[model samples]
Target: MPWKHADMVRWLHPQHLIRSGMDALVASIFGVRADHRLIVAVGRPQPPYFDYSDEAAGEDFWLDYVADTGDGWNSTYAVARLLAKPSLELKDPNGDTHALERGRILVFGGDQVYPGASRDTYEERLAQPYREAMSRSPDPSPHLFAIPGNHDWYDGLAAFMRLFCADRWFAGRRTRQSRSYFALKLPRGWWLVGTDVQLNSDIDVPQLEYFRQTATYMQPGDRIILCNAEPAWIHAATTPHPRGYMENNLEYLQEKVFGRRISLFLAGDLHHYKRHEDAEGRQKITAGGGGAFMHPTHAPRALRLRDGCEQKKCFPDEKTSRELTRQNLMLIRHSPFFGLLTGALYLILALSAYTELGSHGLLNIHEALRQLAASLVNRPMSLVVGAATLGGLVGFADPAFGRWRVPMGLVHGLAHIACAFLVAWGAMYFTVSTLGICAEPPSPKLAAFIIPGANACAGGWTHMWAKFLLGTFLTFAGGFLVGPFVMGLYLTVSLNNFGAHSNEAFISLAIPDWKNFLRLRIDPEGQLTVYPVGLERVPRKWKATHADRYSPAYDPDDPQATDPILIEPPVRVMPREQAP
Candidate 1:
């Protein structure tokens, strides 16, 4: 079965939050980052001995590149199935037909694994899917290389080094690079250099020296395709920390290391496809749509890049991205587990504030309000919880919103707290009025620790216990449904109208649409060609197939599986000397 949403990683879940904090702490204290890179320097694998530089291979050779993958099973498998195929024919909008052969060399741009780069996650999400797909293909094994992204760096790149740097056979692809980053000599005097930026955008000295050595092998008039973890160009323009090391270092590489040699720059931190071109024809492309949740391309809007490149193409476009943002209104459907978190928090807060309800019970609105107000001063812990919830929401607001986040986030948090109050009151009403139990409310002190019961009647204790259980369940269940709806609605409004939280908003939605990858070829004439291919939707239902003798492989259960399409016409780059 395709992995259910329940099995998917829930960012709001407490367990994940705890693990993330621990990983951050470890990265800070242990500082294995330097040691990990040193180990790679020592254990560097041999680069491909043969050059694809001019007639390096037959005329039919091509390569595949994908990034930001290894998350959900079905979605990852969808891209894997396409890549593993021996060949594919997709149509561009102009009715032109483009044929793509399975890449002889598979280059993973960044973040091949999600959450963390543990061997377990890579086996299940990354290796297994590709393995299943390759089993059906008749083609011989290909060469593989990958660079670590932030998620891969979560374990300080230990798992990534172990899996990708070992130079072993994996998923029908031979791991060629000895380190997390690599430099490959491609066909026709063109080189592909991939760098490791790790968690910070700054490249380590040893790794930069490795690339410096790569520059020595480059001859005059040679062109290069540079790949990095994050799109430095985009960050230069879109983020608050613009023009920092991310862009400056890339420029340093171009000016000091490989001047006028870079023909293209490729990256995939943002989970969508965007291509920008300078007037001189040099292109910087962001094609991250490799099976992760769709990020809105409409915001952080950069029509003209830092280097004077204009936007040429974008998959799902800005219009479609805006439309998809509307799905946040249906937030619970996408992130139902978020409700579990809120429900539990609400239950705890209500229990703490039980003393504030007084002898009047919840039936008396005026009296209940007075006690609730009193609890704000008397019960500091409950007030602290409510304040934290409110403050967190404020911080969650986009920093770009300026002071508006204070009001907007406070309103959002207050709305949730108000909902909790209503659930508490309703639950108490049912316990006392509907069930005729808890005629005398229990002490607030005991309620916070245990299920408080009445002691007046012989069986009043039993009656009060039943009332407590029923009230608690009702309050929690009601809060669960109400919580996500509130959160979803707030996220929807902030993102659609204010253009905020593109990454955070969609992760909650987990939309499995707009998945894409890049396929490249070096023609016999020595020109490079790129095809930006994508599918609008992933197959929701898949069936296990023994066909093609690939056991454990799957085909879409949906009778009419969607076909891939070109986001734009094939981009052809001529040799540097031959440029018009």
Candidate 2:
């Protein structure tokens, strides 16, 4: 329980000030020096893009991005192999085979690992896997960069900073950026700006100033590719304008600090892939599908559609998104390990109840069941009536059950809770009446029940009444707390699977086995193309490299794949907004 106590306290720290304090203490003791130097670089050349654009005197560049997908438990080994491979080998939907080349720069979006951001977690989850990938590849390693996500900040960014910022070889690549944020200067007046949102707090003064100085070096017409740690705009529940500090800061950087136009805005906290373009042709893409669990493409909270944006154009169509959502929900239902764990928890709870009551001579299993059944003789009618009434009301309000889901669930859950309390009271009354414990006088004193730690007694009829009242109250209270919790979980799972529609906010699915990433190539003319690669199997080199490590990190005996297949027909990046 003490080990679990830390986790309870840690989650309570939503602002993460406590974690930050711990990080400060850790850094002081370890003599950890934080880095914040910006790195600028020219992009790699791409012949196809250069040939297509034609008038190319400048160089070309490519950057691959993925986020919220660091899963050391599964997929990371295969993902590492894919990254190490020179190019993807795959067949398109038309059965045409092609090799999609790897990007020259590999930029991680964030959330490098699940559970927490500890050094051991990073070593196994990210560093060791990628390091092996680099070693197995014959080609030179691409320049590696990373921005911290909220998960990375869970341990106050200690491991993230060590892996991505400090001047050392991690994952078989030297840390290039001095800070969590950096600016990559591309050929032909293009720039890649990565920012640290600092765990939902405002951008630190140093980071803001660093970007301002970087902006001073740029011209007004420069095409900028913006990258952030979280998708603040899409995550907003009510409206896009209200819950968007990241957007506000980026807007200020574009309009005031730099006076430049943004070509592409990229973020990856949502753990799924999405592309949304405004009327002005500015692209806002969320591509977090790296290797972690998948998320659903739910509808945004606001029902109103934006001007000039159709259903599928703004986001995936409802049918398509729903299918994706279903796939994830089904994955959870069929997960062998998850089901096993749930069963284990129920067993533990049952055992705990039996142990506590058995020790106090309060539990007689056969007698308890017999009394429980007798108590429930007249109970079914009330539950049936309540459920039927609620069901009728729900059906009348919304046949599809979309708009009224939350309110309906809450009301129905409360009814079930009340029923549980009544059942508990009846069962307890039957048990105590049959056992005759209530008939015993308190500590052999006068015919009465005495308070445990008080000089108080209720004699004669009052003693029996007091015992029954206390038993009923305690049982009802326990049942009231537990019944609604179980009912809520069941209803939520049902709605998540069969009901709820998503836009970009209501993510309630885990896309199992479909690991993906994005490769963006900028031509000499400053035009960008995006290739979304999905892994269908593990790579051969991944199986061979550090083969022994697989057992501890991931069981090789498990029925996962050995080679990865890529998703076909990559999406082309539309042209940036024309320079004003």
Candidate 3:
């Protein structure tokens, strides 16, 4: 049987629904955190981005967006270099030498690879690269650990289990995890707790029980560094967005498991770096810049409410937001992929128009526009317009909207609707302008060319129009649904694997080459410091030189040409008790 687009959509619909339902279930079950003794720490370390085999196979149609070879400064080479010299030299507040050991346990927040979880892709993209890195390095390997992110769960966790839970080895690194979630007892009363937040902050029964059992051994004043795949708190801090799912999950974990003992909470998924401190002095850091498309740090205008969803007053204002916006601009100017995607979409739309307009020159562009306009005069269109207007009004109802322009559900929904309408209109115009004007009756061969199965069809003019309208409607609806609003959100919200795999409509979004990772170090005196390392220094002409494209891998032999540099000074975190 031949595969149909509708069939593929049907198959994928339930799979996505299942994942969503599972997230809801997990959130319900572990909705509230429960108390327990400290359990024995499980030592398991895994690499980042679960899949990257696109190039290893034939040229993948989509995986190129997320695949990385680590040959360049951003992938395993830079990270491996850091691991080679596994410790950093620092100074205490008193100016004394403070030696910080690069963690013996390497915790991967999540997203081991891209375009879904498969062992082959993992081996090609993750393990071998790290193995190569370790082979070249002089330092002993650290115990690798990981927590499953959404990408890992996309394939039903099969690849994730095989790679991490089944004692698989990536180069010299071994996966020691018995399950996805684990507790690690570190030195100096420090504990690393990594949780799986696959769907809606959900934890499976066994994993929850494991943590519950693990909590029994906890001592008072014990500090925790919580690791999760999604940056829920940062998301929650956004205003007028469904206020607190992530915050609730974190609260659950903090109140029940550690009892406010969490010193620092770390999360990935967003391919950028950000840090936030709340009124309670709880530190939430997003260090996901781990070799995926770089996320823009610019504070997005709240799509829902005024004062834009900044809970804890954490969103950076004008002056500080520029840095992120600058990076975003650089990506836009440098990457040519987005432009290619847009052009491709237009071409496809034009060809599809040809199929309908070529054989039967019956439909006139002007008449279609007239009919469309006349149709919109009906009640349905009015209601749609009215509803959209109402939504916008309610969204901007918040007094802060006057100053901040935060968007709400109504606003976002209206934007989508508006985008759909505009797209439908534009599609019609472009189709008619190109195909309608030159449309002519097709010859026998031309007819066959226009419709692949034309010979099998037994139909008159009515039948031709029937097929044309049906096909055109479906095509137009699809283009309308995934229109500008959806594309804009991909950039603004930074969701859906940072638009990896060409899931997004336009090519305006550019993936950067700065590959990043974090080293979580605990000093002899128990102070926790984090060092964010990029594979190479972001080139000075990055904006100009990388305007067209950036390389994923660098020369392995000339590793020193782009040695990993610490992007910022070491951040010394205050212990949980001292945070306030």
What TM-score does each of the candidates earn? 0.89, 0.62, 0.57
* Candidate scoring better on TM-score of 1 and 2: 1
155-261 in candidate 1: lDDT tens per residue? Answer: 77888888888878777778777787788888767788888877767676777677787888878877888888898888777766665754555567767887778
Best by lDDT: 1
310, model 2: CA deviation in Å? 6.1
Candidate 2 global TM-score = 0.62
Of the candidates numbered 2 and 3, which has the greater lDDT value?
A: 2
Candidate ranking under TM-score, highest first, comes to 1, 2, 3
> Each prediction's Cα lDDT score?
0.76, 0.52, 0.47
**Each candidate's clash count:** 5, 16, 38
The alpha-carbon deviation from the true structure for residue 473 of candidate 3, after best TM-score superposition, in angstroms, is: 19
Q: Model 1, residue 198: what's the lDDT?
A: 71
Q: Model 2, residue 253: what's the lDDT?
A: 65
lDDT of 1: 0.76
Candidate 3 per-residue C-alpha lDDT over 261-289 given as tens digits, one digit per residue, 9 for 90 to 100: 77677887765566655444455666665
| Tens-digit lDDT track of model 2 for 308-410 | 3222222233455555544432333323233332233332222122211211223555555554344335355444544554564354332234556656655
- List the candidate 2 regions with Cα displacement exceeding 4 Å: 1-60, 91-98, 136-140, 236-248, 258-260, 299-409, 412-511, 536-568, 574-580
Which candidate ranks first by TM-score, i.e. highest?
A: 1
At residue 326, candidate 3 shows an lDDT of: 34
